[model samples]
Target: MFNVPAITWTLTAVLLLSGSYHFLQATKSHQLTDRVNNILHALMNILMAAMLWNLVPSTMLAQIAVLAGAALWFVIQAVARPEFKMLCAGSQGRLKCVYHSLSMAGAAVMVAMMGLATTGHAPAGALPMAHAHHSMTPAAPSTAAATLGHSPGLAIVLTLLFGAAAVVFILLVLRFGAAKTSHRHGTASGRSARTAHGLEAIGAAVMALMFATMLA
Candidate 1:
């Protein structure tokens, strides 16, 4: 069986760091739109982290509502704030555009997984927070991975969704890496690009392993 706790904590850390980077950058720059974007990204990460660690409500209605809100929040952003939309400029930065699109798409997948679990499909790492102090380590909660395989349909669906997401992130890493490599000036932008690429690679690999292990 896969080591669920290890991956859960690792992904949680990655998401927190990524979200913090953008959030802080936005705050410093006084860019309200970027702030909103980063905040939503952070919220999505928290929702996943919560699900992974069983840190939210356990009932189907409660779970579905939270996940639905997270999912709809993305749509709400695009509709309510034209400037915050993920749609990239047509003039330049094709790679950046692709990255943004993939990020949005990946968030959507998170919502899908939560929705599936909300309906009692019980996809891997789908449990919620402990209801009481003593119930934290519910024996059933710890066996999320084993239970995942029991739902063949959800397993296959997750396999495809996360597999494709992994591929997208790999492409994103390449996209960022290429930018870093081609910039021989050793400028501030180059350093930032490299750091971003490193994070992309880690996130891609983590999610890839997660979906692969759960489906297997």
Candidate 2:
């Protein structure tokens, strides 16, 4: 969760939009794998946005489980043999699956971290994933120490990883956009691809920022 309400609200809106777009794409997709992929993206985004506001606290563990399972699914797709035509076949497709696997795993880690952080503070009779007050103050020395103890070196590592992912996606967005521009009469498919990359870039950047805040 962010210390700043503005940042939190802005990310919430962006996540909602991204989630909705993915759900829409899922509905339109003809391929079963593509539809499943889009639905997973939609669920992940919506759940992440809900996490920011500590909504549906009882389901946090379930959310983490779902994300971890989704990550495994993507990994399976990535490593499947070429003979498995229904899975990711070519090198590029496999690489994309690998990236998605990493991202889903990262998201699972984030939710788990947040759940642990708040567990001790929740009232009796509530589950470990119960909600707590969202503190806007900078993390005190004691709180930081506790986080460091609970998370060790994980936060900074995720921050760097997501930051790198953001840069890569941003580059993809630029490259795709440039290709469309140069083609003059670029296909609708090209524009849609560029837009998808742009959304990916935004999501990566937001995740990176969120991890950085955990470090702070």
- Against the true structure, whose lDDT is highest? 2
For each candidate, give its TM-score against the true structure. Answer: 0.55, 0.85
**What would the C-alpha RMSD of candidate 2 be, to one decimal place?**
6.5
TM value for model 2: 0.85
Off by over 4 Å in 2: 121-149
- Angstrom error of the Cα, residue 76, model 2: value is 0.7
Cα miss at 195, model 1 (Å)? 4.2
- Model 1 CA deviation exceeding 4 Å by range: 1-4, 58-88, 91-151, 154-158, 175-183, 186-201, 213-216
Q: Global lDDT of each model?
A: 0.52, 0.81
User: Which residue pairs in model 2 clash with each other?
Assistant: none
